[model samples]
Each structure stands twice: as C-alpha cells, then as structure tokens.
Target: INIIMDTLAGLAFAGEAALSRYMLEKPIPKDEQLISEDMWASILINGSVAALASLFFLNYAPIRELFSRGMPIESEKAEAIFLTAFFGFFVFMHAFNTFNARTQGLNLFEHILENKLFLGIIFLIFTVQTTFIYIGGDVLRTVPLEPMEWLYMVMFALVLIPVDLVRKWVRNVWFGNPVQTRVNQ
Candidate 1:
C-alpha cells in the first residue's frame, strides 16, 4: 500500500511540475500570474478523494472477510491495527502529496486563478479512482462503504490542508516572495 501511495505521489508530482513549467513559460502580466483559486480547488478535490477512499477501509468486517475468505482471525485487535495503519497511511500520504505538488516553490495563497487544467486533471483522476473503488466490485476488490465512513474519511483527509496552509504562511513570511522574484528575473 505504501508503495502504491508513493507511486501515485510521484506521478502527481511529475505532472504538476510539468504543468507549473508550462504556466511559468506563458507570457502573462505579473499581477495576473498567480493561480491561488485553482490551487485551492485542486488541493480540496484531491484531499477529498483520499479521505473518501480511506472511509471504505473503516468497515473492516467486509474487507477482512474478503481477504480471509471467512476464516477466523487469530486476533481481531491485531487485524484492526493492521487495517487502520494500512489505510490511514495511504490516506495521509496522498493528501500530503496533493499539497506537495501544488506548493513546490510557489506561494499557494498568492496565486490568483491559473492552472485550471491542472485542477481538472486532479479531479478527473479522483473521479476515476472513486468509481473503480466503489463500482468496480470484484474487479477492483473493494467493498461499498457507508456514508458515515465516508464522512470520517473526508474529515481525516482534510487535516493536511490547514497544516500545509500554515507551513506556506510561514514560508511566505520568512522567504519573502520567492515566486515573484523568479517571475521578475
């Protein structure tokens, strides 16, 4: 699961980096260069997806049954721990990646409204992931999750946003407009 999460992060990072490069190369007025709204939208969309996916793992009975083939567990507590760790780690990692890709050497809060295509791609990827996990059934090896579980997942995944926002705020205060400096040069 960690490997899968890491691979997804790497792909997301590479894609975002390419998009950022393209955006930087485009000739736009300095005052109009920020992509703040689009960045926020991307972060929210990707974070929500991770949170929703994690919810599916909350109802572990079905998952354990599916994996164990109905065999009794040696220890239910151990199983729960393993399941939580596996799912939680993936959720947080992906959520972190969402912000990581968007905030690379850029002031997230200062970007006005650029990068709509990047945001759209993130949403598209999330929609596909959700569809496969929920509707793909046996083909995807996923169990249908309850609404409450989804709520939990969404709440958990959103935790990264505020944390990253704070980090970006600190960077802005300390570093003093690195993005604008690059743009000016």
Candidate 2:
C-alpha cells in the first residue's frame, strides 16, 4: 500500500512539474511577476489545507479503526499514536511539498496560480478521503474520533508551514536575486 501510494504521489508531482514548465513558457508581464504577497498567499492556502486535514481527519475514530481492524493491537492509545504519527507526517510532507512545488526552484509565486488544477485535485482527494472515512465507518470497520485528538493532530501538523516560510525568507535574504534586485532600484 505504501509503495502504491508513493507511486501515485510521485506521478502527481511529475504532473505538477510538467504544468509548471508549461506555465513558465508563457510570457509574463513585469508588473505581474512574482511578489512577496503571492508567496504568502501560496503558503497560507496550502498550509491551511494541510492543517485542516490533519485537524479533522488524522485521529478520527474511523481512520484509527480502519488501521486497527486487522491488527491484534488492543490498546486504543497505541492506535491513536500510530495513526497520529502516520497522518501527521503525511500532512507535513504534503505541506512542504506544496511550498517546494509552488516555488519550483525559482522562488517565484506565479507558479502557484498556474497550477490551480493540481491544487483543486488535491482538495478533491482530501474531501473524498474524509467522506469515505466518515461515512464508510461500518463497512470500513472504523470508529469516530474525539475532538481533542483532532486538536492534537492539527497542532502537530501546523508547524511545517511556518518553518518552511522562514526558510524561504532566509533564502530570499541571502540567495534570492529577484527580491533584492527589485529592492535595489
């Protein structure tokens, strides 16, 4: 399952890379070039989606039950920890990926809007997953999760975005030519 999922994610990333290249081929006006605001917007949008998914679905009983169903593990705490770690890592990974993909090595913001279709697909996938885990509890052999668990998941998942943003800022200050060039004039 991990292999399959990783393959699918790799494919999705390849698609995003193709889209980014295609978009970059277009001629963009100087005034419409990437700005700091656009970078912030991209970070906020992607980060918020990841945080929400972690908060709402990570420790949800249904998802936990789904994992616990085949295992001989009897402790709910163990299940919760496993699921939290698994989903939390996923949420952070995707959020970081979003930041990397949006920047696309140029540290530009235009790529973010250029790949709206990809972002929408991500949103759709999350929605479908949430629905499946929530509504298919009986068939999936999962249980609903408590609100507190959701909170914990969210808090853990929320750290990645700010860290990435700071990294971007540092890059901008030391290695970024775009922002500095614009400011020098």
Candidate 3:
C-alpha cells in the first residue's frame, strides 16, 4: 500500500510540475495569471491549519484507532488518525509545491531537484541515527526534542521566502531572464 501510494504521489507530483510549467510559459493577458497572491495566500493559510489539525489528531490514539476501524465518530467513534494525518500532510505539501512553483515554473523543475538533494541529506542523517539506535537495541520511540528543533523549522520556513526572492533577483538581474514563457523568440 505504501509503495502504491508513493508511486501515485510521484506521478501526481510530476503532472503538477508539468502543469505549472505550462501555466508559467503560457502567456497571460492583462488580467489572467496562473496563480494570484490571494489564491496562494489562502491555500497556504488553510493548508497550514489543516496540517496542524492533522498533527493534533494523530497524536491522539483514540482518533487514530477510530478511523482505522472505519466507525463513525458520532457512534463508534473510531478514527484512523495516522491515515488522516498522512493524507493531510501529503495534500498540504503538494499544494505548497504548486503555489511555490507558480512564479518560477521553468526553475520549478530545478528547485524540485534541489529540494530532493536536501531531503536526501536529511534522510541520510535520519537513517544513520536510526541505525545507530537499532544497533544499540534501543526502543524506537519518539524522543523529546529540543526547542531549537522547532526554532530551526521556523527558520527554514522563513528562509524559503528569501530564497525565492533571491532566485527571482538573480534570474532577472544577472541572467537577464524574464518570467518563463512559451515560444521565446
């Protein structure tokens, strides 16, 4: 199930990336744009809220079991919190990616690849840590993380805005590139 979902998610991500490229390249009239600031803002706000809610619910085992049992919350009150959390995180991440790609469709592909590099580093570190823990025969339970971890996440989020700004600036100033458009003469 995980493999299937992972494959499907990749396909969907690729299609979305392609669509973003098309949207970026397709010329807009004086009015039309692929993504408006309002739209992106709303998506970001709502997605953040939903992701938080998912995390909260997932932390409660009763909620998780309820959904897994396929019982009504009102009557049986069973919830699959993990499933809900997974879907929530999955959807929000994709929405964020789509919004992020709106202004940089051509470079969106490049950014995706760059992000993969970062993700790979993160995963490698995590795997090494997990391996060391397992070798020591330590139980794999959630550890209490430092406040710095949260601070780091916040910093990362803040970094994205400036990263985009820098990319746009470099593209336009140093590279003399305009917004991506199809049929560049």
Q: Report the lDDT tens digits of candidate 3 across residue range 76-185.
A: 22222234333433333433344344445235445445345334433443344434323423243223222443232233234234445454565566655554324363
What C-alpha root-mean-square deviation, in Å, does candidate 2 show against the real structure?
A: 10.1
- lDDT comparing candidate 3 with the true structure: 0.42
Could you say which candidate leads in TM-score?
1
Backbone collision tally, model 3:
8
TM-score of each: 0.47, 0.46, 0.29
lDDT minimum window of 10 residues, candidate 1: 104-113
Q: lDDT by residue for model 1 over 1-185, one digit each (tens)?
A: 44344555455545443445446754768788476653664467655755665565555566444333244644554454334333444545464456555664444522413545445545555565556446755564454444554444456555556555555556567765446555555
TM-score of 2: 0.46
Off by over 4 Å in 1: 1-96, 104-114
lDDT of 1: 0.51
Which pairs in model 1 have colliding backbones? Answer: 34-112, 35-111, 35-112, 36-111, 36-112
Question: What is the Cα-based lDDT of residue 155 in candidate 3?
Answer: 39
For lDDT, the strongest prediction is 2
**Clash count, candidate 2:** 4
Ranking by TM-score: 1, 2, 3
